[model samples]
Target: MSRLYGDPIEVWTRDGEPSQFVWRDRLYLVRRVLDHWVVAREWWKVREGDPGERQFWRVEASPGREAGSYELRFDTASGGWLLMRAWD
Candidate 1:
């Protein structure tokens, strides 16, 4: 278990894949890999074209630190997942 922004967060993996996590009444995927792990928050952002903003984390499980991830921007206006790169 870890705490972020004063919120209690619990993380567990199954077969190295980010299987379960909870934050602010929301469920997240924390995928774990041989080289790294990932955390994703599918949130709605904007109202029209973009869904708005999302939170993502690329974790380096080997080194035990965040490897940097990205915020997914959904164009609610466009009604689709932005085809942008993870780091873009």
Candidate 2:
């Protein structure tokens, strides 16, 4: 099972894709992207003509020894990255 954190993080990107991420002072390197998708904000929460969308990236990353799966979310409106969930 994955644990949801929704914690803010710092991510480094290459070619508009996450290449590395820092969470809780630890760095993890992205090995490969497992999946990608976009989610639109709830219609009621978004004003007309507002591009309220979030992008999610499922990636296999490793801090050192072995890899773990992580879901990263990018908020277009806030221009922030979050560590949405993680699996060990």
Candidate 3:
């Protein structure tokens, strides 16, 4: 089964795409982007200054050994990145 992290992460990007990230004290290079999507909540459903839109990228990443699938998120309201999920 897949796991959800929701942990804050530091990400590096190239041409507006995620290229690498540091999570839990380990660095991982994004090998391939498996999918990309966006989640946007209705305007009336969110509070002011807390817009409800997030960009998500599902990618294959590796630190050195076999790669793992990771889901990254960018919250528009806070401009912060998070490791949303992972699959081993």
52-80 in candidate 3: lDDT tens per residue?
88999999999998999999999887889
Taken over the whole model, the C-alpha lDDT of each candidate is: 0.36, 0.95, 0.93
**Per-residue lDDT over 1-88 for candidate 1, one digit per residue giving the tens place of the 0 to 100 score:** 3322423445555763344454446554533432332233355533554434443334323212333232222222432322122221
Error of 3 at 50 (Å): 8.1
Per-model TM-score versus the true fold: 0.28, 0.91, 0.88
lDDT value for candidate 2?
0.95
lDDT of 2 at 62: 92
Top-lDDT structure, candidate number: 2
Q: Which portions of model 3 show Cα errors greater than 4 Å?
A: 45-52
Q: Candidate 1, after superposition: displacement of residue 83 in Å? A: 26
Q: What are the RMSDs of all candidates, in order? A: 13.7, 1.4, 1.9
Rate residue 63 of model 2 by lDDT.
91
lDDT of model 1 at residue 81? Answer: 28
Q: Which of candidates 1 and 2 is the stronger one according to TM-score? A: 2
Best by TM-score: 2
